[model samples]
Target: MACISSDSSDLYDVLAGRPRLTGLALAPSDDRLIASVQVINGEGNAFVPGLWEVDPAGEWEARRVTRSLQGEYAPAFAPDGRLMFLSSRENTDPFTRTSSDSTGPGLWSLPEYGEAERIVHHPSGISAFTVAHGAGTVAYTASVLPGAADTAAHAEFREKRESAKITAVLYDSGPTRFGGADLGPAEPHTFVLRPDGTQADVGGQGVVGGGDLALSPDGTLVAYTRAVAGSDPDVNANVVVVADAATGEVRRIFSRPGHHYHRLVFTADGRSLVSQRQRELTYDTPWRVTLVAFDPASGAETDLLPDFDNWPWPGSPVVSPVPGDATVWFTGDERGHCPVFRRGPDGTVTRLTSSGAYSSLCVALDGTTLFALRSTIDSPPDVVRLDAAAPDQQPVTLWAPADPGPLPGTLTEVHTTADDGFPLRAWPVLPRDASAERPAPLVVLPHGGPQMSWSGWTFGFGPWPFAARGYAVLLPDPALSTGYGQRMQERGLGQYGGRPYRDIMMLADATQTRDDIDATRTGLAGHSYGGYIANRAATLTDRFKAIVTYGGQWNLESFQAETDLHAHARRIFGDPLTQRQRYETDSPHLDVRKAMTPMLVVHGGKDYRVPVGQALGLFNDLQRHEVPVKFLYFPDESHSVGAPNHVRILYETVLNFLDHHVLGQEWHRPQLL
Candidate 1:
């Protein structure tokens, strides 16, 4: 393999200024494709995201569509061939109060040969929308103040609150925050909008936030998910419901004691509704997910693929929208990669793509062509076309806006059997020049989610950056990782530190045995659940010279109480009073006195999921024990430090810490830090 020269190779340089294809939509005729690509504007300063039209079968020409400072999203073709999307662009409607200064995104439409116009505007803006394939009905969700029924009422309440400077929000629910934002006095409501501007509320009073909604083919019926409270106040599940779009009549189609249904889509013939059903979490049971198809007329439900073991990715289970055909398509993580699968009308499922991860799936109404964004460990996302009818033909790249150039390192896999005879695996990125005579230092990085596997391509804390610096980085998928089967995830249920920690050590042991790795100079780094494992390893072993833990749980009891999703925490760890022994056995804070390694602790101050207290307590304990420790804190960032400057500083600071501790070099503190 040819390698980029040392002086010219830089991972940041290769990744900078790369435009991403964020969304895709196929025209009604299946001849042209519309994609949302985010790119830097002419000045090369800030991003200006716009829609681009691509020729799927012709010369593969791409033409830019909408150009605005605020990007467009969720592009879809109406039955009448009009292109509709969501944007926060300035509304030209004089009667409406919303303007360019408003933050809410409104619905915009561009006809086949007409200029773009704003069709729908809400006080709180639209979150998501769906279009009927047969009829021109547009269904969307928007957040509104609790006592406000209409858009005018919502706007009135919002204006009064803003004028009064009333920033306090009183919630009657348990969760008060999500995704780094404050959960408001506002609640999500689904509504049906017509082209003529007439709208009706169809989601009913029981509408739940975050549940997906779908519009039926004929525009008469709409399917959506609603929340159902469990016996416990903190526990809640979901059920699917079908409602009349015009009459507001609704009926429950699917519900079970422990199952929640979402990601809904109606079949072309309007007879069946397909959804992803997930079993609620418990102390002993994992979140097992499967697909279920329900016939609305006959009240019959069938499990689509009972034998398929992998959990389907959230963006899938898209049913063909055209009449006379009933084909379903989805993608699932399987054995370190995401593969696309197709299920025909006769109930036979077939695997379509063999490599790379696929997302934003769009199937032609005729059910003969499919479009998706495909990406791998070495490649960025690009639009690709697949022959749904052939199933075995290769995917043709339709549009690729960005390239990472040639990677300075190559990725490979390593595996080992645990002491208990269970199989374990890890991905290693090694520089091209690595050999027996000149081995590379190893950094063992355990994946987060403990249940989420490291597969395909990921931007944050991935392996390639370290490899570009001549260090081999190993990403281990331990006992609880997905894609290997539900049995593997269940193996670590209720006990996070026992089996999963042992799996990481076993995989690291195997990697160090390779001739191209230096066992004497090894370090460990992890984030989230992986951070918990790193903290556990620090107390249990003195093998690694240095270790890094970010957003980790130090005290299990406090973490369970302060986490944003208290229900999820209780499901995995149980009640602190009833199951105190489990917390004591698994918590790293209990064994902090045994730690001997130099450690770097990183955390985001605004992170509500793990909370900043975890890092504060760990740092306090380390300082009292006279352990070599450094705390790198980001006060404004949430769980994910997504700002470009912050991310660059993070990578540089971590590399500097590792170099000083593991490579025995002088500490060179980052200027920003």
Candidate 2:
């Protein structure tokens, strides 16, 4: 059961047709492969996610895992070959629904090709589970704080408070109880289940937050990250702690301030633990990676891959089990694109793949095979397997169903110049069917996270929907993007609407010079920080024919005051009262009346990070100026537009709006005005 996009010439169609399937798991005894698949019909609606099992010979078939749960994620095979996954059941009690207090998440298990049974239930949240090799024991993180029953009420109150300053006494009402009593407190705690279904707390008493728990091959020791609440959340008081499985005796082996240790793994010998520390530095600080190995017995720590000059941003470390060969594998940026690397015991590094395709690597049991999702900027994600021992490992597509057809465009990556001559990266997808004689409409997509950058993926945001309607899409990764070093990220700290806006304008100008683009028919769109940029871009230029923003910030001052972590906001932007000029200059509201582009605003009603007020501020400003605009609010969403139905509606609305403004199509009837 493979999923493929249905729209002809759709960017998703080209990428989804690339044959990448995800959620691959292999059984230890027989080495059979099991994977979870998303099935799509000809109408482009994703049917439910299903579980599939493939024989060693590569023969496979699939069965639906949950009929009731609409969104099922993170499926894995239990040691006994049974399927275990997470799903949220719908709540219908009117009072519960209105009060924002409902509990429905549960850990469910089903026999291989059998019905699903609820194994664990929680009203709060449960995530990141690791099952022992034989399936006799399972370890997972469960939040046991009060107010788990009412997520809506909790969210509403949390939003209203401006700070996450809840009374300390209410922390004990967690959603799940193990061994007859609640874990107590809403903070995340690690728990383990024995063969008989009985559960016990694995972390020592008083351990507040735990993450990335890894069990030893023999199931005797557990390694996890322990985070203690500090006076400030931005300044994390965290350390890597290893605990004994039987006695629950804990020992702290490593500590780092303002740096997070994650992706814990035990070496084959089981004597040492390896972990990756991601260190974030401010504009005035230096960035470093301290990869350390800790001895469980003496509590001594050794630097294996210390702060090297040329280092990759490490993610999800895995260790091989073969004796005399202690190797660690992780994903990092080796040469611009994310790739998998194997660090031998001697500290030598080996690059495994070279297609420059974006890959998320996950290792199998014997360390002989690697499963990954490989994709390019113009390609949809596909699942591929790499033979670790093969001299020339070619990626074989595990799933490539029938395609909707080839896209009408060619996607190309181009290097452009920023305001200060810093090199910027942008991907431009031009219509293959377009000619120099005719001009094609263009859409400038600003990626979310002014801090994050657009990477090696082909389909971005609502670009596919517009591309299917025959518009060229341009995605830019300006100064404040990740993959580039720390300095590049901090460059836009106080220049949100300043240099960043200039860089985007330059990219737009560069795109207009292309033979296949229509300079007259240009539009802008983005979400989060991208939303902020898009709104500001509209005010800065009448060159854009249409503008759309999802969860964008309108007033930086209001955002800083309303957002969580007031302390960090003060640290990042300085006191708004003191830096009033900087805040006003960076905010889109200061120039809202200057906006000339026809605009559409979309927001999740429940978003906390940017909040709905941000969108309302922009919408009200547009209305005050008698500007042509429409606003669509999703009642059941957050910072991200999660629901499939809502996303579909958003895509349709964006396409119609772009068509009217940029393609000379019939104007979309305004919904809000």
Candidate 3:
């Protein structure tokens, strides 16, 4: 795999080899450089971590940062340019009675230019930490027990009984000691750092915690989101609160009864605060990004950008420190694709990059440079830098000295009408070499999250593999997809295998007419909710030539009964017994005898969510009925196949099966019991 720059204009491949860069962090300085690296082997078989420094000229230098630690991650540069990181020391004593002898998470610091040393060690767990902008003080949240024995006991209890209560403590940078002021028994919230080396909790009392806390440039006021308890499926979180750092007095500046306050930032002059709010929902709730301005003196709120769709799922909003300007930078979704956007004082939105497949973005201290992580289906993630001041400037790749494989085909937006005339959105990825004369086979790839929408991104299974192998892929985001609005997501409730199934079939029908798609050799694949769709599609229609399910549920009844998150399922679906008709109608087991498509069922043996028994039940039914079916079980894998070797084998096996059934091409067959 190779690294591809984010700027479409300067699209050039960098790095050429098997080792793929997996993680990246950019320095705060506007030097267009990255501070860390996570690499994966060429076959995507192994993951290795190291620290690196990449200069503006695209030069790379890497060194092993933590040799004594087993697993290290979440590295950040301190105010004084020192590297602060989290690492878990290897605990070989299987029978150790003390937490110190058992594995524990610790925080360590190293000169941004030197060797690493222990900073703070928590016998229980260190959840998070933040360094003051220029104060060189570190404020962190940690869960600690009374003693080593108690820590060990809590760990064992969490493993065996699945229940353990740990105390969360907030501490300022000081000499090593396990004691501090108790933040609370509840989850640790975001800590706002003050310039004077003091930190305050932004989250108040409640289960509906806080996220994305932003402090003003002068560090006078802090803005954060607060969710109200018992508000499910409602997009609007309760309120956006602003607190005075000096007095610790807080005021609720903005409130949306059912929508969530997603992101917050103060204006350039600190005269007003801007925040993004969206309606909250349990399943698929469509979200809209609205910007609100708050007055500091009177606690008055006003809408700055009422129609600002650019902040869809907006997060990490940062107001520039430069004077005489009121611009804010944030990342949000546009038409199902997430992109980084910079909003000018006049409310003009400038898209920073063409590629919408990005998880995070951060602006440098100068506020003129932007560092982002971008990825797509065929490409692994890499950090890239963009000059925010010059929108037309080219992007520079900062990690992974290789070219990403060819773009995983081309995705085109599609819409199909369900039985009720409701339009569903979908994306069809056509084969790279597809043409009217030599049409490719079709793969109907239903998305998981029957509640979550399939946002356009580079790759994560689905039709990407099939399309890469000369097949066309159709991905349908049925009524249950979020971001379309609350009404659309609520359509999935008590209607699984109903409207959602019809939506997928309609998408398949629309794809069959594509000049580069062959309807006769179509297939279906999905995981989780998608797995359920795959099984249901095979049983409901003979249009598919083959089907694959990854850790998918076969029987909704068994799923509700066996899943570890039974409480969540119960809340989402109500009482299963009362919704017996919906469960029966949705279960693939009910119509397994009707399944004619050659099916491959894959499951991780340790998956407790969609238990392996779900796959086993479907496989057993197919076997009893003499259906052409295969089952592959990974003993050490879980709901997700995390091991590199297992992942490679799984993909190979799936491709081989698809080749044989969908393309009528002979391929090596893996042994399936």
Candidate 4:
């Protein structure tokens, strides 16, 4: 293998075609573990995620289970030793033939001694599902049109609208859009399938299945979060609900005015329900998440991690499978790492794993072993097994795809102190042989989410490829980044351009002090909130030689109104109409005249989160100011830009722009661009 910079095509291939393992499921009895492995299909053009059955305790062989063209995910094991998943593949159900245009994912089942078949078909699609541990009960969520009686009626409604060429939709309440998805003519509904082959609608007249659902071990109860519309339109508070799996009877067990609960799971004995309780965002306060255990009988709530400060990463908490066991396991982001944490029955939280981000956590049926996919900042995910009783021990690698080989560089950490005395840390990817005599140019890269942290492995906005191009990429988790304590997150609330920007600069300064990095030639790049930081940095200081912002927010005022999450944006940024001063002071567009560094603006036309107007606004501002700038637009892409070729073009254009600006080379356009 050669240095990635030697051939741009090679860099794209390695990053774009790398195999990924996600969505884990373990069988009830023996050592059968299932994972959704995403790899380049036989066509070698598109990456498809398919289910793989692995024997971790034996020879560690991974056998392909499903090979659908559209792919399969969310693997789970039914109590009857059957493999189930959600897929958008052509439904072959003879009873209800789905039209050719109906490509929504349906619940599929593959028995140990039988063939795979579609078990539950929905008109819109099944998004997520959970199965009972000891009983033959399965619960899934799907979209249903208002006033429709059942799946048949929903399908007919869709067909009539299509036949009439009517594309118009009306929404009386709630959000019209969330991220890349438009708010529905059909709301999400959760359905329960009993052991006797009868179906019941558990979620009625509310967005119940919009989040996550969990089925009890006995298959009698289903726990999930339901949306309760507030007095204001588009504003709703999520409350935890328990439903009768067989009778379709719903009961609202928990509700709070300003807090939301979701990611519900039941204890082994069905005595307690656990959920992630999140406080709603406000203009002055940052949203926070904490795990809570609720007593379903007495309606009492207990804070699981009352003393823990770090935020638990998004995933259902894995409760103990042994009956009467009250132990819970999860992972949280802290100091650039997402490590496993265990909260015992006594409410004591302990750090289980010292490194790697863990997800798809599952405890074996016998309660002796645990299985999860673990990955670090420098490696892809690998399926591993751990002793549930002694989880502090090292995990045994069960199955990992063929290594993508070694990187041209290695990962290292840097530390700094913020202006307010908060400790700041960053991960820097330095090229091989980067020394004082051969220093690599520094690229200050920040993670998005203003509230999200860069704690583990990620396919988006990677730092390794840049290191292959002889750049030291600095990934900083400044104020407002999660995984840190609530205080660290709230430090920069409602002030994107304030402490967060300053903390990024401080971390960048610390990285530049390293002997392996070049202090004089530095660049800045970010996506989403990170992009907002890049734009803010450009206006605040001329320290960086070049800047790149993707799906960035240039004008807070316009963004609060145009974003898909309008209410959310307004909650964080404040209302533009009444809080005019906040917008004027925080928006990067208001201070475009201060920017001197050359910038490359990137955006996706269909990106509803930040919207294309943001990129257009920034490009126009740079042009009006006569600053060196370039725009890369992807009309078909969205907020994350997952298309392989589109990703290639994104990095290709970014590298070209950086080489010309920071490296002081001729501005040669990329071949693909």
Q: TM-scores for all candidates?
A: 0.94, 0.81, 0.73, 0.95
Which has the better TM-score: candidate 3, or candidate 4? Answer: 4
| Residue lDDT tens for model 1, 1-673 | 2334442225754564567777789887787689888765565444566898888874757888786778787899998889999899887656764432357888889987767888888877888889887788988888778798777788889888988999889876646776577777777777898656688877542424543888778888888776642235234466677888876688545777667787888888888888888776678787677888888777778888887766433335978866667788888877777778888888787888888888888887678889988888777788898977565456889888765667867788898998777777778888778899999999998888766777777756776667777788888888878777777767777768989998888899999999999999999999999888989998899999999998888888899898886677877788998888778899889998999899999999999989999999999988989889999999988887655566667778888888898899999999866
Worst 10 residues of 2 by lDDT: 172-181
Q: Would you list the C-alpha lDDT of every candidate in the order shown?
A: 0.79, 0.65, 0.62, 0.81
- Model 3, span 1-673: residue lDDT tens: 3433332212211212233444444544544343445455455445555555556545654435555425466666665566777666553334533444335556677675566665554445565554434345444444322221333453454444323443334333211121112223233344444545444444442333433455554566666555444444233346676776555478555675555565566665667777765554333333344566677778786665556543235655666656557777766544455567788888887777665555556666667877776655445666677777654344677654445555547878777677877666778888667888898888787877665556544323545545556778887777666556545655666667777888888888887878788878888888888898888887888878899988888887778776765444554455676756666677789888788888999998878777889999999999898889998899866677765556556766887888898888886775542
Clashes of each: 0, 19, 35, 1
The best candidate by TM-score is 4
How would you order the candidates by lDDT, starting with the best? 4, 1, 2, 3
Better of 1 and 3 by lDDT: 1
**TM-score, candidate number 1:** 0.94
RMSD score of candidate 4 (Å): 2.2
Ranking by TM-score: 4, 1, 2, 3
User: What lDDT tens digits, residue by residue, belong to model 2 across residues 1-673?
Assistant: 2432334334444444333345566565535555556654344544455555554434464333455535555666666777677666554434434333335455677685556666765445565666655334667776543343333443454444435664333342222222112334455667776668777666631234444776665667767777554344347636777776655567554765566677777776677788877665432343445566777888887766654333335556667756456777766543236666677788876667665453546567677877666665555555567765443246766643334345556777667777787777677877665668876788998888665555555333645566667788887777565556545645666676887778778888888888888888888988888898888887888888889898888888888776643444555566777767667777778887788788999888777677789889899899999989899888767787744445566776887888887777997654532
Residue-level lDDT for 145 in candidate 4: 85
TM-score of model 2 vs. true structure: 0.81
Return the lDDT, model 2, position 62: 34
